[model samples]
Target: MVALRNLLTALFLPVKLCLFVFHHRVGRVRAARAAGDRGAISIELALAVIVLVGIAVAVLAVVMRLANTVKGKVPTDPVVTAAP
Candidate 1:
């Protein structure tokens, strides 16, 4: 039981740290946002998501263009072979 607990703790150490950090940062942002504007975090998050999605779309477009270009350069016609 002790070994299992230790193993679980070790495995989750990074996750715990990440959650802690995320919580701390969000708390600070919430406090800051509370002073003047409400829903500021939501607006910021929405904008960030939009920007990230746009970036993802651009990257996907470039990848698809390259893939199509490469595919066009490859020979795809079946070869005729004389059977012996």
Candidate 2:
């Protein structure tokens, strides 16, 4: 049983080593690819657009509120009455 176990271990060692090396190399390759500067501009542009949109929304909200307040304060009648 011990010899059989040894034989099995010897047979599997090379396969395990190959798998480990392949996985490590593939992981390194993926990491390098991900760390590269590809698509950086697109990401930056998306972020900028998001920020600008947020600012625009805030400005529009403020303007709308101000407009509503001003509209409420304006009078419909323009005729001035003279005091007797």
Candidate 3:
């Protein structure tokens, strides 16, 4: 259980760090746009959203496929074994 917890923490840390960085970057871009820079903040936001949505959709597809595969492998009924 300790090992499992450590593994989960290790895996989750990077994802959290990435999200934090993305948020920070977006905030900075927004601040720059607010400061009257003739920048492509809209384009950057659109691209980021598109990429995130694409990743989400891809992950959903993979999860659905895995769920279906596992469901297909499960027995529909309980098995009976004779007592020794």
> How well is each residue in 1-84 modelled by candidate 2, as lDDT tens digits?
999999999989967866785576556556656888446545654675687679769979999999998898787647889999
| TM-scores of the candidates in the order shown | 0.49, 0.45, 0.66
User: Where is model 2 more than 4 Å wrong at Cα?
Assistant: 1-36, 76-84
Q: Please write out the lDDT profile of model 3 over residues 1-81, one tens digit for every residue.
A: 999999999989959976996888779787977887635776777787788789879989999999998898787757889
Candidate number with greatest TM-score: 3
| Candidate 1: regions farther than 4 A off | 1-37, 76-84
lDDT of 1: 0.78
Candidate 2 global lDDT: 0.74
1 versus 2: better TM-score goes to: 1
Worst 10 residues of 2 by lDDT: 37-46
Residue 48, candidate 1: C-alpha displacement in angstroms: 0.2
Model 1, C-alpha of 69: deviation from truth (Å): 0.1
Quote the positional error of residue 11 for candidate 3 in Å. 6.2
Predictions in order: lDDT: 0.78, 0.74, 0.82
